[model samples]
Target: MARELLPGQSPELLKALHILTRDGALNADSLRKLKQVNHLVRLLAPAIEDVLARFGDPVLVDCGAGKSYLGFVLHELFLRPAGKGSLHAVEARPELVAAAEALAARLGADRMRFERAAIDAAAPPARVHLVTALHACDTATDDALALAVRHGADHVAVVPCCQAEVARQLGEAAAPAPLLAPLFEHPWHRREFGSHLTNVVRALALRASGYAVTVTELAGWEHSLKNELILGRKVRASDRAAEDRLLGLCAAAGIRPKIVRLLFPAGAPAP
Candidate 1:
């Protein structure tokens, strides 16, 4: 008997994403992975629905889209029914882009487009309602945040990965004796601290850029190391305190990020 997914469920997408076997059975680990993906979609679904309710249709840009799993699943479940929105998957790897394009074509997902470009270099489209990045590595996640801000996107969702740059930089600097010694004694401690700093700075940056931010644990920390989702929505205008804290965090870490300049321009007041 042929396997079939319930209508509106995304079994085909899971197979296309290589998250499931051909026999339609999810293994112990695959189940965890699928759960995470499902939970992420669920978490973002309300926001998407809310936006659709307020504004007609929304354009979503998924950065570091990899094989476009999130894009495909989202389009299958959310954008398809609405029939008014589009999805753009931004990825730097040509092979992954090609694979995503093929899967999208096979799935008849006409509303989606796969672009081969890093988020930093991606050209701005007219309007984007939502921006998402799942496990985008290190500072690349920052680049995605900057892109979302540049486009004036209404919602920004990010899961950061492999935060090494800030940690390495922080290691070179001196922390206070007790805290500094223990933190620097082990490489892993330094990495963890860097990860923490990265997220904190990112949150502050988003707040400064006028977006209300929420940091939450993604459903699958055991399945994947990068399991924190940072969700932000534009609430009001730029916040001075957020910008000031962002600059202060950058200075303290000694890792100067270009996103700081982009998010908080020269004329902006200090936070």
Candidate 2:
């Protein structure tokens, strides 16, 4: 049963995305979905405003946009007639891409475009002002973050999922058998360790690449276990010491990332 959305409470785009259902009522699933989107929007609001102030009509790209839930909800709630910004969604899944495209068309959201592409390989339009990736898996989040850094995005928002890459890296590093053997044996332990290591490296990498990073819990844990949202802004330059340390961590883990070098040219000092 779908309950009607409260007046002035639900965003039309969210309704179309099925977060509100046909009747607008939010169920247990819808409630979780809404919380995630709402948290992201709140975090990005100030950054979006700042970008708009600088670049008349900012362009935003959503990578790994699984069904484009963020895109639809954002457009409905924030983007307006007076706002000339557009949202381009990059999704690898063909069905999701098609569904998102149809939904955008049905809603007359001319500014929204959905394309099929992996996060690592996505080529966005020239001059993107913002880049967002919600629940992008493992290194895919890094891929999206790399894109944001390369494109000089005014802002970037990411909620990461599945830290397998980092876990693998962590596993390769030598540690006491008594402590580390258990992590490798237990699925939950591996996931917890990997999640922590992934975010720590990511924050350091962003700082090394000239972005100020802020990490916070996105909504509540009930929304999802992958609830950490890392918000990055290009208000400051990179730090050479941080860059060295970041590279050192990769070296220590024996995993060579494609982003470190691209973001920090010649290992130059932070400007």
Candidate 3:
């Protein structure tokens, strides 16, 4: 006898994703990974539904899409049910892109397409309704955010991972902020502070770009170390005060000019 399937989940889809074996059996590890992916999809479901309600045929771009697990699960659970929408999975690895493309074709996921491209270089044909970056490492997450903002995505969901940029910036600082000097004295503290500061700057940047930003734990710490989930919904007006605070934070941390320019462009108000 075969094991029971999750509601609304296709056995074929699971097998194609390799979450299930050829014999349609799942081990403990596969089940745990699937649960994690499902949890992430649930977190973004409300936002996706909102976009679908507003736009009849929504488009979603997934940056640094890796093996395209999130893209596949999202299409399976949401877009396929609606019988509309498209998902573009952008990955730098040719093999991963080819595999994803083949799997999508086999699954008859005609609306899904996999592209071989980096997050910084991906040029969407049109503005997308939603953007997602799951565990996009270091500056790749920033690249994804920049892409989303540039394309004017309606909703952005990102789970940043391995944020080394801020830590490196902190280490290169000629003079650390007086208030934060003690925290930066130790390597471990510097790593933790860098992670926190990176998220803060990112949230502020999104706010500066006219997004209502929310930061929450993506999952329990025990389950994943990279658990911070940042959700952003585009708004009509940008928050000048948040931008101002972001600038002040940068100055205090003695961030490099390049990073400042990347996060807050010139010709933007004095803030």
TM-score against native, each model: 0.88, 0.84, 0.91
Question: If the candidates were sorted by their TM-score against the true structure, best first, what order would they fall in?
Answer: 3, 1, 2
Candidate achieving the largest lDDT: 3
Q: Give per-residue lDDT, candidate 2, residue 34.
A: 69
lDDT ranking, high to low = 3, 1, 2
Error of 1 at 237 (Å): 1.7
Return whichever of 1 and 2 wins on TM-score: 1
Model 2 per-residue lDDT tens digits across residues 158-270: 88887786566555555423534565446666668667767877888888777888999876555368888899888676677878888766655444444554555464222
Q: 172 in model 1: Cα distance from truth in Å?
A: 3.6
Considering summed lDDT, which 10 consecutive residues are worst modelled in model 3?
Answer: 262-271
Candidate 1 vs candidate 3, lDDT winner = 3
True-structure RMSD, every candidate: 3.6, 4.5, 2.8
Model 1, C-alpha of 217: deviation from truth (Å): 0.6
lDDT by residue for model 3 over 1-271, one digit each (tens)? Answer: 1334445777677777787776776777766666666777778989999988899788899999988878888888888889998898999999999899888887888889887988888877577889999988788888888888878899999998888877777887877679877877788988998888888888888998899999998663356779899999998667888778878787778664333466577622221
- Of the candidates shown, which would achieve the greatest TM-score relative to the real structure? 3
Pull out the clashing pairs in model 1: 240-271, 241-271
